[model samples]
Every structure is written in C-alpha cells, then in structure tokens.
Target: MSAFSDSEIAGLKVARQSPLIILQPEFVVRAFTLNERLLVCNPNGRLDAEGALQHAYFSDFTDV
Candidate 1:
C-alpha cells in the first residue's frame, strides 16, 4: 500500500523474492477480515489508473 500511486506502482516492484523473478507489489491483494468474502477494488483518489496504462512495461508488450 505504500506505493499507492498506480502510475508509480508499475515501477515499484519487489527488490527480493524467493524465486527472484520479476515480482511486483500486490497493493490490491490486501489483508481482509474473514467476513469479507468478495474482493472489492475501490481506489478513491490514491490510484491513478489512467496514467498507469502509459507505463513502459504495460504500454509495450515486448518490454515484458
């Protein structure tokens, strides 16, 4: 959740992981209470989804 900005999120990947393959942060996969069964994505103003689309990784399919 630290890197909440969707535009910046595309570049903010995890530096380390077990397998060490391109690991991105799971801002959307957050801890939820047992009562919460459905997954809801409600980014009020923190996430800039439009700008994220222009990111190099996502904009260019070959880059990934």
Candidate 2:
C-alpha cells in the first residue's frame, strides 16, 4: 500500500493548520517543523549568548 492514502492526507492537512492569535507585545508564539522543534526543545540543546541573555532578562518579569 501507499504511504499516505486519501483519508490520511486530509487528516494531515487538518493537523498542520495553524491559526493566528494576537498576544502581548513581549510574548510571541511560533510554529516549527517536527525536526526543528525537537532540536530546540531538546534537553541537551544550548542557547546562544544573545538568546541566553534575552531569556535571563525575561525570566525576571512576571505577567502580573
């Protein structure tokens, strides 16, 4: 059988749909492919200097 049949293709399309939503100026949401997400989310992954600094700065603030 083929890898993806007609019904499976339709489900895949639905699963990949992303809807835009607005957030506060300081916050953002992004979408990534499975591999990209895995790399970024990996426990062993390291953040670059700039990213680390930004994360540190943001870590000090609370929404309230």
Give lDDT tens digits, candidate 2, residues 1-64.
Answer: 4657766876764455453444332333322222343467656675555554445335544541
Off by over 4 Å in 1: 1-45, 62-64
What residue pairs are clashing in model 2? Answer: none
Q: Residue-wise lDDT of candidate 1 within 1-64, one digit each (tens)? A: 5546766878777865443232433322221221132233554533354544443435335443
The local lDDT score (0 to 100) that residue 64 gets in candidate 1 is: 39
In lDDT terms, how accurate is model 1?
0.40
